[model samples]
Target: MPTWDNVPKGQMTAAVLTNPGYSADPSDCFTYSTDYPRPTLPSPEWVLCRVHAAGLNRAELRGRTGAAPFIGEFIIFQKEYREEPPKILGEEFVGEVVEAGSASGFTEGEKVTGFLNGGGKAYDGAYAEFSLSHRRRLYRLPATTKLPWNVLAAVPMSMYTAWGALNLAAGLGERRKKDNKPVVVLIHGATSSVGVWGLLVAKDAGATVIATTRNTEKIEKLKAAGADHVVLEDDIDTEVLKIAPDGVDIVVELVGPDHIARCANLCARRGTAVLVGPLNKNWSAGKFEPFYIPPTRNVSFFTMTNSGPGSEDADVDHPTVEALLSDVVHKIETGVYPQEVVVDKTFALRDIGKAHQYCEENRAVGKVVVTVP
Candidate 1:
């Protein structure tokens, strides 16, 4: 065993969900425990990391509130709530490798950032002093990058989801490569972290990006973040029609299922509308009719977790995810993508409940992060 510093004999401090159910106040569900068992490597592909910072996602809030159907099932079906230790919730983190298995291809003290399907049986998450991650789930940060741990922590999940939604699911990259025509993209909920990243990515790809935000205060910020035009969410269709005339070539729908019809209608003929996030906390689209989606346009769904190892399509999708992550890191390093634009708030790990509350209230314009000190 490698000698580890600041690690207790077999335990570590972590913010855990003592109860997995809805609470109007997020603080009621989380507890800080000093004796939470340090997760061990399950196999040679996994490594233990000392988490420096973690990024909060809306999914965690949904999962905590029992709104996430799959995550809730994973926790309840595993009987995690009835167990001695409850579940930890987090998906993206920046940290250092403290212990590595041979196949993990990482050395002790190597700085890294990663995303995992946390709050599951395989391993706990990054809302702790320590986290466990598989080698494939991580990206080794370049030594010369000037980004901080909190900013780096904000990148993995949001960036991966944005890139996947656009390139893999919606074929933004392929379309850009094949057609010399200008591509117009509409990113709904563009003030959210993933929406902002999607705007940046589409802009970087030379698209004419029109972004949407309900808050008028975020218009200038969205423009600064590379939105060609920013419109109020209430009148997006009217305003966007004024800009594009024939509808946009792609629509990144981060709002929720309830708005899929509007998103599909906004897509140009033969264009795609990719559903990336549910910022509105609405999961179901009841009483759907196929006519709601125009035949000339397409709608697709994307989730980063589904591409991880062991998923049905992982063999085909995982490698693409790895390449995309490395490419994103490279872009950040080269100044092609801005890192500072994505992080809106930082809270200490001890203030996790407050962090959750901040995100749940939709108060953050970008990513909300918690640093572990």
Candidate 2:
């Protein structure tokens, strides 16, 4: 590997989750890897970015805790395959462009953040002090934003997924002023990192946001995150009916089939359930057909895979990416969305496995960060 022209040597430190082909138990957390080689730097082939802060997303939990492999043969080889071992995995991140390659706009030490390509599956992700980002896939972190390192990293996977599902795939973001109403957005699993974003976007888009959380304690936090009303998962139906009798115009479902029927019930005519995120680490990651979709109701289900295949797919929708990132940055800057509420906990890179367990327990209010000392 070629040395990054301006970046220093030996600055690498990352929380690495080892993938052992089965469900991870608390005891499995006994060993956590640290300071493993950061992605090496080079010349024309690629440029490496030094990470300042990387947010912990649920997808990272899935990859590390026997959920899925960061880079499986299925993605890289263009063939059928099973899961592979895990390397450093993270879905969303905030970093600085420390080394620019041949073409240049990004300067060394410029603050920036973005999501992992290809859903982060089989993709080497950022969870370290230094990592490589394909210059094409990376972007500026937005000039107006001032998020703490952890919060900046947290935006990509969860929030972008939420934005794409509701607005793009589910056909919600297309609404013009005349069509825009104080519509109701039913957000499932309100305390999930993405769930926090659904609440943020729905409100900013002029919709009334109704969020759901398994733990009652999270309800207050969801409200603080801009949920118009917060309800426990068990009481979803009653809460939505009481608050928005017209029914929900959109449903961001984090909990899957378990809540499918309930999601359909709350939807208004032509409403959609952008149900890509599943809360449990053990389940196959996806957004399946709601247990039922009535012709009369016209409810649609969308997870982000509809875009294309592998890491290269998301780039096809550059405008979508630009809008989502810009919108999020605006909210973050104006305090419409505060990064402080998005972190559940943080651990040093040495405690990588503990971070995995924290995410696997499925009790986090938001992101679980692994920071370097």
Candidate 3:
């Protein structure tokens, strides 16, 4: 157990999702309250963090609209919340540890950022002034770091997903090492946060990147983010072939399953296509045939939340995640990674609905963040 001697109060402000269904108005999804009970340490390995900022993701929108079947079938049951409890919804946060259990491997007042099993029964999410997380899911920020809380919060989930999908799931790093030539990568939905990060990461790894967007206006923006070639969504196949005649070595698919067949067709022989996002909100591939992709090409899926503690599918453990995060921080500090391209906007926690609306409307060029001041 941990002592709460430093805690200012037992209650804290939180944005709770009392309703979990689709609504035209985003504000209808949450019931914000200042008297929401602050969570305590679940065990000695857990720590209580004073949240400074939280990142907004499409997953939360799916959670709100009962579109995330993986979360649970219970999400669609309104009657259950009346009997049980309505959980908070958020996945990534940057905060200071206020109460550290003896076995948590952390001391009080340390700044950390990482993913949480948000909205799950075991632990509440980061939509509160305070949240609880196991030590394994967190990365301690250096005392000398100068990054803002919102920027730090935005990096974890997007960066982790992009890095994991490309390197681990799609084997971009290994492919780069093996191939004497520069590996070619295609990032579909290149304007999304994950797509933006994927473009940066692939460019940083010395890969020739071809990025795609629905709007032609964002083509310049993608190029500015280090894309060697930018193609409109409709012209992706034609334009990509013009750039890489042999097809791309890796495809980071952020547009969802609707484009899986097309993306797979664009892959080079023995290349990999990793689906990392569901931006279209369409879960079904709609008559997608497995035989459409030849045995020579591969299709894979990646979920950033799978790496949280206790997940059997997690390939990279805590220490590896921490090291990657540390490298990202160094890149941000040294201006290698442009901070402006990482976070597009910030909203106060009270205005979370507006933030959600902005993100869902696709107005943000990068990540949308909610600050918990």
Candidate 4:
């Protein structure tokens, strides 16, 4: 329904896939769509940014492969998307604002970073040179001297999801009290991007943190990210129990079905456990009461999803969501949040097939980013 007449002049190169199917590497799914139209402000509150870098998410792979909640059965399909010809598959980006709408609060030349969930939801994506986003979702970035543009691409998606699960789902920030003994938080699968950001956000909230990761090399890095205790994935229960005799106040479970019950059992009475990622192949846990019932604690469970009631766009200026996008950026700017940009690898936009292949291989330690020339 939106028109491109208002879109900027000039052609931009983008990675696109016209057909959909499963492949061993998924590199074959991509085609370099040349002469793409540059994006313009879609609304008065939106701004058009010239994307410098875009990060890949596992959901992109799932969507390409026709997985549920992404592209298969559950996710609704629109006729416009089907008839639109090429499909772009990226959600997060860091760039410079090229044009601002009349009501957009940002300046034209400011650098910004943000997550726009439009690949399968509403708008196109950031794989192209130019992308549009709501002004409230865009956060001003410090000078490239403070943080490079490529590095910030890894922050928006993972950090925002982590912040959302904690603030929106678990209410960790609202419940945190500095005067009292710090709240205890547990992060399962802490080596992943979301898990690592959860650890940092929990620590930034003044909570005592326990993290689980298989990588021995990242133990010290995890500690530096404000984790009070870092233990192996298998040792989570033992190490966490040893530290918090009662149980943890909050649990961010990145590992799925197999570990969900254990994570729930580790929560204290009236505690909260947020299941942000389902890494396990099987999501069904049989019966909830029998397999997952906490022995002593009546804990609450929150499942983080891409589309839901509170799963709206990230508003930096107005943070109804658990820390605003601006809040997390400030944390990184100030010394409260970890400033490390853990990019596993980078690829040119034309070689996006290789980028998706790299992420599908599941060997990358952190985020896989694609650079736009």
Instruction: Summarize candidate 2's per-residue lDDT along 1-373 as a digit string, tens digits.
Output: 1123434356366655553434546335334445465555544535577776666665555555454433321222233223643356665567777777666445787676645543344445676666666554566666756656666666766777677777776666664433555777888887877787777777877888888878877777777777888888778778788887767778888876456666777877777766565675334324546346766454544443322356554532445565667777777767777766656687666666666677766667776776654
lDDT of each: 0.76, 0.63, 0.79, 0.68
lDDT of 4 by residue, 65-163 (tens): 655432221122222233222266676788898989889888888877755653433466788888877665566666443555666787777877788
Segments in model 1 whose C-alpha atoms lie over 4 Å from true places:
1-9, 19-24, 66-68, 71-86, 118-122, 176-181, 305-323
The per-residue C-alpha lDDT of model 3 at residue 229 equals: 89
lDDT at 189 for candidate 4? 75
Candidate No. with top TM-score = 3
Between 1 and 4, whose lDDT is larger?
1
lDDT per residue for candidate 1 within 226-253, as digits (tens), equals 8899999888869999998888888989
- Candidates 2 and 3 compared by lDDT, better number: 3
Estimate candidate 4's alpha-carbon lDDT, on a 0 to 1 scale. 0.68
- Which structure is stronger by TM-score: 2 or 3? 3
The residue-level lDDT of candidate 4 at 328 comes to: 59
Q: What's each prediction's TM-score?
A: 0.85, 0.79, 0.88, 0.77
Question: Of models 1 and 4, which has the larger TM-score?
Answer: 1
The candidate scoring highest on lDDT is: 3
